[model samples]
Target: MRVAIIHDELMRRGGAEQVVLTMLKAFPDADIYTIAYNSEGTYPEYKEYKEKINTSSFQIFSKSIKLMQKFYFPWGIIAMKAVKVTDYDIVIISNTHCAKYVNIDSKALVFIYTYTPFRLAWNPSSYSQYNNAKGVFKWIFDKVISCLKYIDFKAALRGDYFLAMTEETAQRIKDAYKVDDIKIIQPDVKTRNFYVSKQPGDYYLVVSRLEHYKKVDLAIEAFNELGLKLIVVGNGTKAAELKAMAKNNIEFKSGLSSKELADLYANCKAFVFPQHEDYGITPLEANASGRPVIAYGKGGVLETMIPYDVHESKCTAVFFNDQTAESLINAVKTAEHLIFDPAFIRKHAELFDENVFIKQFKSFVEEKYEEHSSSVIKSH
Candidate 1:
């Protein structure tokens, strides 16, 4: 079969990009289509698939990440519309943004693996930038989002099948697109690549993009008050502002290799995850390294982390109820008193291994394709 994979953009090595890379491994022969491609800005592994990767007319504007960020919405929609996938027998869209709008053959089986319905368009309140805007700018932003949401909803109807990264995201898809039939397929981690250290270091760890929504500031505040060591790994638009807010106890690092990150996970006392994510992978990565997680008790983490309960012996994390420093600090104190088993933590993480994701994803595609083929034959 002539298979194609369409992703929103290739500008950064975030969780969505990681899912795209895994999809590439599952369908090695499939040609990749994207709105943008930035070799240095994204994962180096993508270079291996350079020949099979194709971009849209927006590639010229996307060459600069800053320019792409400025005009990503309407331009993304236009660029995706221009991508012709009509020749392909199957088109799998790995979408968080606008890739669902790609033109495909009427006979092609199109599967959309979505991270979340376009958050900026459907849920503008979640974004700090959007909330910070005032008067005419906020009014214009809302008007544009309204238009984009309509377009996004129409694009969503084109998918022959839909897969969500988590149950939380599935509900979001249903609410945003009004699409009821959705499958939940959680993203996985390389559990085997991590190992438990016999001796953990004297610091907590955080591995996430320093974004406004991530709530890294809460961690900084909690750690500052506790006067404990914290090593934050990852950078983003909020890097400078976050760095300035952090005290001397909080150290920031970025651009570490996978191995380096795994090592940090292995040696840290515990992982700090303050954000409410669609489906978080960092907490699982920490658990894979046989470390406990101190996380906000909401969103996708609730599905992944086994919260500390007196009745549950397999608990791998302590949960904070709110996004405030006091709530997190109290959770940290509770975690300090509890004893976690590394073997059990690692075992829990193994349930969401990359191999499992590949197997399930491939099987689902093959089964659906066979059904589609049978239907096409009957139609003819």
Candidate 2:
């Protein structure tokens, strides 16, 4: 089948982009369609696939999409609808927000891999920067946000099937779109890239986008109070704010090669994850490196991480119930007390390896395609 992979944007190299990459491996000949793309802005490996990518006119603003997304959504829907993908037999939309609205052939099966129903639409309060506007400014902001949400909801209805990244995200999809049929498929990590380390160094590691919701500031605060060595990697809008708040013990690093990041993961005392993600892969990556994690006790980490307990020798992580510096500090103490086996931790992470994901995702898609084709034959 001629397949086309559609996505909202390609501004950064993150979990969603990782999903796109895995999909490309599954359907090697599939053409990629998206609102915007910057070859250098994401993983360098993606540059090799440049010939197969097609971007909308929005590519011109790819660099600043983070700032212009509010405006991008309303116009992006119109732009995507006009850009045809009718020639393809399968059109898979990898979306968080607006790419679900892309117009395709009525007979084509459109599968959507939803990261989470547009977070700004479903849970605006999570974003402190958006909520900080007061009086008339806040009023206008809420008004526009609400209108965009309405459009996003309508866009969601266009998908022939919805695939959620986790059970947590499936609930979000059900709550937001009122859609009952949803499939959960967690993303995967390259297990071969990481391995068990016999000796660990004196530091904690966190590799994440410095976004407000990620709560990197909390990790910085916790590490500061403990006076521990914490290495914070990745960059985003909140990078400057987080840097200013961090103590001398907390070091920020950005743009590390995969091998370099694997080395850091292998040597770190423990991985630190402060965000409540839709489905986090970093913790799994750390586990693959045989390092335990200190994470916020909620969200997708619950699915991937086995919480550390004094009695549980096989636990791979310690959880903090609250999103606070004190909570994380306590969790770190708990991690320090536990006995984690490097080989056992690596074995746990093997369940979510890239090979497993590629197999399951391909089977799901093929099954759906066969069902759709049989039904169409009967309709005649």
Candidate 3:
């Protein structure tokens, strides 16, 4: 059967992009469709599949267009709507935004795998940029978001089946689209690429985009007060502001290869994850490296990381309840004193390996497609 994969954008190396890459492995022959793609900006592995990748009209612009794409929501919507996947037997959308609006053939089944309902449209208050806007700007922003939410909701209804990365995301999809039937298929980590190091490094590691919502600032503040070394990897809009806030003990690095990142995860004393994510991959990546995580005790992390307070023997992370630096500092201190078993951590992470996701996802699609075909035959 012919299959087509649609993703919102291939502009960066992120969890959602990773999911799309995994999907490609499941359906190697599937053509990929997206709103925008930046070869240099996103995963280098995508270059190998360049022949099968297709982008919208916006692809003519430079990479900077991705950063400003939020402002061109209407154009993005139009761009996706213009994409016709009418010939494919199955259209699997790896969506966090407008990809769901893509035109699909009535004979085909569309499976939408969401990272989360578009956060900027559904949960505006969570973004610092939205919260910092002025009276008129904020008013305009609110109105625009309201309109986008309506459009997003209508587009979501086109999916024959919906899948989410985590339970948190499943609930968000339910709230955003009022859709009751949803499947939860968590994303995976490349556990085999990582190994437990003989010796741990002196510095704590943070591998996340330096964004306002990521709460990287909290890690900087805690490390500054503790006078401990922190190595932060990844860059974003808040990069400059976060660098300015960090002290000499904090160091920033970006653009590391998969092997290099796995090495850092293997050697670091602990991985610091301050953000509340839809379903965090970094913490699991850390676990795959046989390292413990120091994370905020909320959101998707709760489902993955075994917290020390709850299950001391099985714990893979230390959880900080509050979002403040003081709370994180306390958790860091607690982590410093605890003994974590690298072997056990690695074993736990193996459950969410890339192969596992591929197997589960392919099975779900095949089973559902069979059911869909049977129904169509009955309708005739």
Candidate 4:
């Protein structure tokens, strides 16, 4: 079958972008459709996909447009809708943002792997950019945000089927769109890249964008108070602010190769994840490395990490309920007292491996395609 994948702009490599790459592997022949593409800005490996990538006229202004994402998002939706995907038999939208707004023919089978309803639309509190606006800027923000919410809702109604990334996201979609019958398709983690280390390192590790909603600040604050060695491995808008707040115990590094990341995951005393994600893949990556996680016990982490308790000898992670430094510190202190079985944690991670994802996602899409084809035949 002719297949095409639509994704939000590809300017950076993150969990959402990783999911798009996995989808490409699932349907290797599928062409990728997006509003813009920046080869050097994202993963260097994406350079190979340059031939299969189809972008809108918006790509011509990629540089300036990306810097103004807040203003360009609606334009992106417009550009995506203008691009036709009717030629493809199957259109799979890997959307954390606006790709679901793509226009497809009625005959084409379109399935969306929804991470969440747009955060700026449905859950603006989680978006730092919007939450930080002030005075006149806040007024403009509200006006644009309100308009986007309306447009986003109308666009969401166009999907033939929705495949949620987790139960948490599924619930959000149901609430936001009032749509039922959503399939849950979790993203895959490459477990083989990581392995258990015989001797764990002294420092704790956090590998996430230094964004406000990611709550990297909480991790930094907790570690600072505890005077524990912490290594933060990612760069983002809040990098300078986070660095200024950090003590000598906190170390920051960026542009680590895959091998370097894998080694850090393998040897870290514990992995820290303070954000509420739709389906947090980092925790599973940590588990794959046979290292326990110290995460906020909310959102997708609940589904991924096996929370530590007295009864579970082979627990994988411990969670702090509140999004605060005090809470995370307490959780960390508690986690230090628990016994984590490296083999058990790695085994648990194996359940969500790349192979499992490919098999399940391929099967789900094929089944939907067949069913939709059968319905078309009956209608005729």
Candidate 5:
């Protein structure tokens, strides 16, 4: 059976890319497709798959038309649709953002890893850029978001099935697009490397992409008030600006491997997650490492972490009601009083172990194909 797995891009070995790789392992013979492949050397897991993956026709958009691509996402649709994939029996789209836009032939099952549809119109960067753009350019970006929101549904209708990574996203998909039928396929977090015996309980840590929505500034501001040391691990467009705002107790760090992140996860006094992340893996990492996570009680964290009475008996991690700095500070202060059970934290995180994700996802793909087979037989 010829299978084609589609991904938004392999820009980094982040949670989304990990899902695609796990899919490749499940269907070793399947051909993988992507719009870009920037994570070429960063992740060694795909060394053998280097030859099996299909590159997109929109290679230029990977670089030249990049920033503009967010607002003008149809350019990506036009770019990806050019690929000839009519021959495959199955086409699975693993997406956080853009893989859903790819066009494929009928008959193949289009299973999507449905992360919440980003609010394109209110997206901070595009909104900021649109507000500042001169004359016609300003109108163009604003129009594109509204236009793309419409196109998104037209494109979304392509999905034969939907796979939500978390319950929060499942609800969001239902609310955002009115699509309620969904199968939950959580991402994998390799826990073999993270063992918890001792922790570096001095500094609170945050590992994230440092995007505007991540609300890293909120983390920094809260920690600043608490006078607690904060070590942030990530680099993004907002990194420099965030670094500039860093106080004496706060430090901005980046470019750490998963192992290093796990170490921080295991050692940190507490993990600070201020973002309304789509589906953050770091919080899972913190849980797997037996570290308590301080997260906003919204978005992905709502599904991943638990609200606890105290630390020693925390269900998973704790969440603050609001995403603001003050709310985070209050949560952190309360967290300090709890007596955490390292074993319980690790055990809770095992629920989201990468192996489980792979097993469930593989079953979903294979099951959908089985359903597809029956429909074909009945039609004939």
Candidate 6:
């Protein structure tokens, strides 16, 4: 079967790109379609099989599609409408906000990696730099965003199937779109993370997009209470603001190699992830590095992390039930009290390894293809 994978943008090397690369490995011949790309050393493996399907004409004038993803749904339609997608028999969309854009085929099967798009996209504070303009340009942009999201939702009706990245997203797709037959696929973890061994490094580590909702400020507060060293990694508009508000325990660092960060992970006292995540990769990285993850409970943490009980002998990690300074401070203290076995921690992390994800994802996709084909024929 000829397959095509569609995505919003490939500017950064993150979790979604990793999922597409894994899919590329499974279907080496499947052509890839996206609005923009930044092919540094990020996707070296995909270079051999990867092909870009251009939609630049529409993209040039509407580059705001990505910037205004949540506020204006029209960016998805503007970007997606540019593609001539009637050719591929099977089209899989790796989506958060742009999944509704792929061209419909009678047999088109869209598997969306939705990370609570409604919440992520629409929250003004969570995402800055939207087209918050005025006059005719602002009015035009808002209208476009409004119309596009509506179209995107209607376009989803044409898709043969929907696959969600998490059960939370699946319920959302069902609730928002009345999509009944949603398939659940967990996010994949990078196995290379497990290569290092833990020895309780000097600084506590945090890695995520520096968004307002991530609550890096709360982490700063917690670290201040304990007087422990903390290292913050990631970039965003809030970086300067966060840097200014940081206490004596906190330090900002970015642009580290995977191996270098792995070393830090192996040595860190514990990993402090203050925000609730939608299939977060950093916590898994902490697990792989044999460093315990202290996450804010709620959202994907319940599914992805196995929180260590404060009393456990070989405690892996701890969770703060609430998103507060006091809760996180207590959780951090709990982690400090526990004695961890590096080997055991690393072993637990291996469960979400990339190879295992690849194998399972490949099997799942192939099985779905056969089932979808059979159903199509039966419908005739």
* TM per candidate: 0.97, 0.96, 0.97, 0.96, 0.90, 0.86
lDDT of each: 0.89, 0.86, 0.89, 0.86, 0.74, 0.70
Estimate candidate 2's alpha-carbon lDDT, on a 0 to 1 scale: 0.86
The model with the greater TM-score, 1 or 6, is 1
lDDT of 1 by residue, 1-380 (tens): 98899999998778888888888778889999999899977988999999999999889876576688687777767887988987888899998787888888797889999988888888788889899999999999989999988888898888989999878889998898888999888898878779999999989999998888889999999999999899999888889999998999999999888789889999999999999998898999999999999999988898899999883357889999988999999999888887889999999999999888888898899899999899888999
| Candidate 4 global CA lDDT score | 0.86
How high a TM-score does candidate 6 get?
A: 0.86
- Compose the digit string of candidate 4's lDDT tens values, residues 9-55: 88776888888888888899899998788886677767878999988
Q: Is candidate 2 or 5 superior in lDDT? A: 2
Order the numbered candidates by TM-score, best leading: 3, 1, 2, 4, 5, 6
Candidate 4 C-alpha error for residue 49, in Å: 2.1
| Order by lDDT, highest first | 3, 1, 2, 4, 5, 6
Q: What is candidate 6's lDDT per residue for 1-380, written digit by digit as tens?
A: 78777776665656777788777766777777776554542445545654554443344433342363443344545656666666666777776656456555564665655555544333333444443556886666556556645665776676666777678777777776677887776777776745555246678888866767788889988787878899998776578888888887898877777777777777788888888667777888888887788998877767777778654546566888989999998888877767877677777778877777667767877787788889879999
Greater-lDDT candidate between 3 and 5: 3
Instruction: Mark the regions of model 4 whose C-alpha exceeds 4 Å error after superposition.
Output: 61-70
For residue 196, what is the lDDT in candidate 5?
84
Query: Candidate 3, residues 71-115: lDDT per residue as tens digits?
Result: 456776787788877799999999888888888878789999998
Cα error, candidate 5, residue 67 (Å): 5.1
State which candidate, 1 or 4, has the greater TM-score.
1
Residue pairs in collision within model 1: none
Q: In model 4, which range of ten residues has the least summed lDDT?
A: 64-73
